[model samples]
Target: MTRSANEYLKRILLSPVYDVAVNSDLQKLDKLSASLGNDIWLKREDQQPVKSFKLRGAYNKICQLSDAQLAKGLVASSAGNHAQGVAYSAKKKGVKATIVMPATAPDIKVEAVRNFGGEFVDVVLHGTSFEQAKEEALRLSKEFGYTMVAPFDDEDVIVGQGTIARELLEQNPDLDTLFIAVGGGGLISGISVFLKQLKPDLKIIAVESDESACLQAAMLAGKPVPLEHVGIFADGVAVKIIGEEPFRLCQQYVDEVITVNTDEICAAIKDIFDDTRVIAEPAGALSIAGIRKYLRTNPMQGKKFGGILCGANINFHTLRYVSERCELGEQKEAVIAVKIPERKGAFRAFCELLGGRAITEFNYRYSTDREAHIFVGIKLREGRQELAQLTESLGSNGYNSFDLSENEMAKLHVRYMVGGRPPSLLNEKLFSFEFPEYPGALMKFLDTLGERWNITLFHYRNHGAAEGLVLAGFDIQDTERGEFDQHLAKLGYIYQEQTDNPAYKFFLSDVNGVFEK
Candidate 1:
């Protein structure tokens, strides 16, 4: 090991994190272990006072600060758990803290920061993301002469997070593999450094959300690089770039980095609840999701594997979306788009083909004169392979079907906008829109559009996040197209015209008949 690696390991061994952070449990997940045919364990960092592992690093760093630095107070930027950690640590140290958080952060987290710090911390809601909030925090630190505490990247913070590795080794020394979620790479970097030093053969699998796999991208580029965009469903780990120090450590010690989709993360959350009766945040559940994915292709029967349940600070409102996607994530639900004849008994015949299988969702609309398109979701009691066999059976029975389980557009938008375009609609345009989600936001949107143009089709669904997605169609004369464009521009909502989207053409367009086999 390098000198820096040795220093990190030593710091972890002597970390003062236990002053404020508990030694979280390392409990066996019996249900998951039995199902996967492996001995699964959960490192329950979610059980911490702040409900996240971030407290370990935050408290350790704060406790180590010089008396002069503490007297000047502290400043940091974070959207959720990190903010809470800093706030809690500052309160414990009797130091004033200023936390800059994204304005779009969940209300639960913003309130938690206030509760943790009480009179010792000031909460500043600024910008739309953590990066923007970080800039604001830096400015505040300069203005107030406060010490800036980084959420990750600093040696002290990395060493503090490494404490988990020490506990894991002491708790279960014979584990074959450990799955750790990566964000800015702090947790995994710290843990991998310590674990690899102690047990050279132990596999350290770094897990990340597919939408925000910055560490994976960094590894591929051989250096840290920023991602242009990242999904915020797993907002806790939605870092656009990995920290340089953490990246270096991960490169040297991490055995592999893998990404999991949103559905898989939700399913993992469900799995955790099934075993422990605790619901973990999407990022927290990512490690178990990675383990589940790995076991599918590489079944290691009876081998001991560990996963970190890094946090449990989930927004209560987001549970609806998590529950809805968990089934699909577990491959226990299959969404399909099908074409059927426009006769009276077509629906009955379609049900007969399903052969008593539970129908989760069914949406249909008559588009053309001779055929109709139906968006259906089937409950898969047998497993993922059953969907393929069912689709094949439908095709052999003369029903044209399209598997939409993996279609992003279908899952996010098209399924909700199933009504066919009207033949009488002339010069019609279809558009998908995204806007900040709040009460009456939809009404405000409609008011901005005015009553000038006829609305041909409209669809909206709330996923209980910061933003709302909408699909709409409008009928306007070519002469009035310029006015429509002006209205769209003035509305200030993010939108993309989807009149030519393939999914729309397949399911909603009047000109396109049932797809040819």
Candidate 2:
């Protein structure tokens, strides 16, 4: 549909989202502004009734429903925030709501949905993915006559989200730029459409988690397309494809779309906590991450900048992972694997060569008396520059080193598991797999992957997300290569071969004749 920006503007002005949703404060980030040398402001959408701006869209969509439609009730599917929004809105309108959430949806979110709706909503734990849960919701809406309240694709929903833009302009009429987090694109579509229409020169930059940048993909493809793979660390914005309407609106109004990695999101999360004492979910902090990135390249002085803390429904355990990686995101730490001699005092000599720089981490397990591979982390004062200098310094001193700071596999799997060299060459093939996180998922994976092959090495970590990331190794003979290929094809999970990955070669696997072990 060709969305009329003016119509959205009119509806936004008249939106009744405030009935259940609060007009969250437009707070100034005094500390962030001072530190970044820019006037940064954050719209506290995390302060909404459901702790998300999603409540606005859900409530508005419900309000637009006719009395008969309301009586028929509504059905919606979401991994988190939208489910709570629909449930809360349904309760306010005295209508029944069936919220279908993936089985892997955060327990806190599921419980919050039930609490907000009281007896007015039924929480159905559906399939392992949003797509599956969404399919069930659609089936129920069609066959059972429930009104389907789309999470981000409907007109009333767009109007509801546009209310944020209305509030933003009102709060800071002279705001120079706005950074918005894009998932399905509803939030940015509404905000960008409204802001661009009102202030033609207002810059609207969309931010996305690099793992699931469906909007950025849409901008490239010129249409919404599904991403073959998507990471879910920032589950809130982990959409595989942008909504059709959202994509259309974004194509018209969005000036630029930038993607941030998990580390950057973690850094932004810390920045938000430091300034506002508010713990933003990974997706909630994307705007701040994007703002920092934009300023790094397009340096500005005292420019009025605005961003939204879209939600704060963070899983508690996730804070641990965030704490560990945030320093890397800020370029305050660098990890490198170095080859040091196994001779006595070799470790001490390496540390001394650094001139007493603080060591953040060091991992080494003696495998051979000839040489050793040491995984080391050191603080950085000049970010990547310092890292380059350190690497060069190590090379000049006859120490071979590899920078694994930007290597995803190294940071995620190898760092924690630095000591697992096969006893002998077992013809092992390493693979990194991503699968839906649910009960028995690991066992199921083992069942399918290890039934015919000998398991060699395995590493898995859960960051309180919808998916589990596993790095597994299997021993396969050359004669079984065809069968192994067939097995991998039969397994539908997303995966990438890591046999040649430097992290694995240096730390986990039996490589070369020398055994970098």
* Cα TM-score per model: 0.92, 0.97
Model 2: per-residue Cα lDDT over 1-517, one tens digit each? 5657788889999999889877788888888899789999999999988999999999999999999999999999999999999999999999999999999998999999999999999999999999999999999999989999998988889889989998888889999889999999889999988999889899999999999999999889999999987888999998888999988899999989999999999999999999899999999999999998888788879899999999999999899999989989988899988888889999998998786678999999675777888899999887888888888888888788888878899999999998768777789998999988887988887776756788888899988888889998888898998989888888898899988888788887787323232
Which digits, one per residue and each the tens of the lDDT, describe model 1 over residues 1-517? 3448788888899999888889889999999999899999999998899999999989988988999999999999999999999999999889999999887788999999999999999999887667889999999989989999898888788888999999999999999999999999889999999999999999999999998999999999999999977776898899999999999999999988889998899899999999999999999999999999989878679899999999999989889889978999999998988889999999999999998999999999886578888989999987778988998999999888878777666787787777756665367688888765556878977887688889877888877676677888888788898988998998877787877766676786655663533
What's model 1's overall lDDT? 0.88
Worst 10-residue lDDT window, candidate 2: 508-517
lDDT of 2 at 83: 94
User: Number of the top candidate by TM-score?
Assistant: 2
> Which stretches in model 1 have alpha-carbon errors above 4 Å?
1-3, 425-458, 472-502, 514-517
The reply for model 2, stretches above 4 Å from the true place, is 512-517
Best-fitting candidate, measured by lDDT?
2
Q: Give the TM-score of candidate 2.
A: 0.97
Q: Compared to the true structure, candidate 1 yields what TM-score? A: 0.92
- Please state the error at residue 217 of candidate 1 in Å: 0.9
